[model samples]
Target: MPTVLVTGASRGLGREFVRQYAAAGWQVIACARNPDTMGDLASDSTVLQKLDLLDPATITALANALVDRPIDILLNNAGTMGSQSFAKHGLNVQRFGQSDYADWEHLFQVNVLGPMRMAEAFVEHVAASKRKVIVTLTSMVGSMATNAAGGLYAYRSSKAAANAIMKSMSIDLAARGIIATPIHPGWAKTEMGGPNAPLNPVDAVAGVRRVIDGLTPEKAGRFWQFDGTEMPW
Candidate 1:
């Protein structure tokens, strides 16, 4: 069976990805910052371990733990938004006024650096699988062309950075035959997405999975929307 690993598998899109992938008969390794609260997910025997992407030691340990195992798909799904840091006051309403650079740094830490680190640690394991694919969850907001109504400075920039890194990784890891792509999961209903989100999380996952299913090595390093359309960086 194909084995897939999803980071931030505790809740929201990450949790949904784990459920869907595991339900499809794939060996799902659901990872989260807190595995203690993830007892429900642990019911799946295939779930490998919980991981904290922000912690380098934990990352290395997780990689070491999976040393001989094959990981087919690696889903870099964990992320944080600046709103979670500065509270509700600082929005586009103020237009960058009172914006916290610290929040930006934290956002980049999770959204950009976290994915890059995870991929580096797990690339070898992914290569050993039948299907070697690394799917980094990016956002359409990362598209420079699509950022006409700019507001989410930190979140948008971090995701954009992730797209760039994932592209570079595709090129760098090509010799190992791994296919990597930065996929834009359209805004969906979730805690991160909020109630105003247009698409339901389940539908969004379905669309993204379809795009993932059809990807080829030629499609590697590309920025694609949930509908499988090429997105301009």
Candidate 2:
């Protein structure tokens, strides 16, 4: 069985990815901050890795744990949107015009730095895999040129930063035969996307699967929507 490793697998899209990949006969490595909270995942013989994006030690430990194993796909899906403080939560906080940098720092750590660090730490392991793919979950809001509706502050900018970070990884890891792609799962109806969001997790996940299945190394580092549209940076 091909092995797939997903972060933040206790809920939302991460949970769906775990279920789908496992059902498809992949050896799933499901990582979450609380493995105890992953009762459903634990029952499936999926490798439950406890990881907190806020903790560097935990990240390092996860890398060390998987060093010997080949991981077909590494989904850098764990992230945060912060509290709905409007300006305080987003652009303003990012520019140092805010009261609480707490959420801002947390968001950057999780949304921006976390994926880069994870990909860096696991590049060798993923290189050893059969499929040799590294996919990061980004957002349309991350597109500075396309973000028409404003106000998600930290979430928006951090995701954009993540896109840039992953771009560098794609460039550097290309010669190693790894294909790294940033995908916008679209307005997925997850907790972050809220209940009124347009796309269901299953449909969105399918779209992502389709993109991954059809993508080539030549397409690496591009921004793609769930439906396979090329998103502008």
Candidate 3:
């Protein structure tokens, strides 16, 4: 069975990924800040690990613990949109003239720096696997060519930085036969997407899994939507 290390496995898309992958007989390293919160998702095929993207020590510890393991896929799925609730306040808190440096810093820590740290720590594990792939869940709001509304400054910028990191990783890790890319999960009806969003977490995650299933060397370093469309930079 192929092994996958997934970050932010407590809820939302991360939880869904765990469910789908485990059901398909994959060995899943499901990581979350609080493993207890994973609840009934625990199974014989899943190993829950405590992980906090904000803390480098936790990341290093997990990487060290799994040093001998070969991870087929390193899924950087943990991220943040700041303290404000998008469901209630919408993008008002992230709008122009409302920028909070502290919140912005937190966003960058989780969305941008976290994935970079994960890639650096787990490069060996991925390279040693038969299917070496690194996937970061980014957003289309990060796309410079697609930006029109221009509101979510912090969240948008952090995802944009993440996209850049994935692109560079694809080039840098090519010698190791690792395929790295950023994928947009779309506006799903999750805690961040608000209740009115069209896509549900099940379908959204399913679509992303399809995209990951089809990843190839030629497809690395590009932005992709959940529906398999190539997104603009």
lDDT tens digits, residue span 5-103, model 1: 998888889888887887788888888888888778765545647688778788899999989899889989888785552223323521466558887
The candidate with the higher TM-score, 2 or 3, is 3
For this target, which candidate reaches the highest TM-score against the unseen true structure? 3
Query: Model 1 residue 13 lDDT?
Result: 90
What residue pairs clash in candidate 3, if any at all? none
The sequence of per-residue lDDT tens digits that candidate 3 reaches over residues 122-219 is: 99999999999999999998999998777889998999999999999999999889999999998898888899888999999999999999999999
Total clashes for model 1: 0
**When superposed on Cα atoms, how far off is each prediction in RMSD?**
2.1, 2.9, 0.9
Clashing pairs in 1: none
Candidate 2: which stretches are off by over 4 Å? 43-45, 85-100
Model 1 lDDT on a 0 to 1 scale: 0.84
Q: Model 3 residue 118 lDDT?
A: 98
Best-to-worst order by TM-score is 3, 1, 2
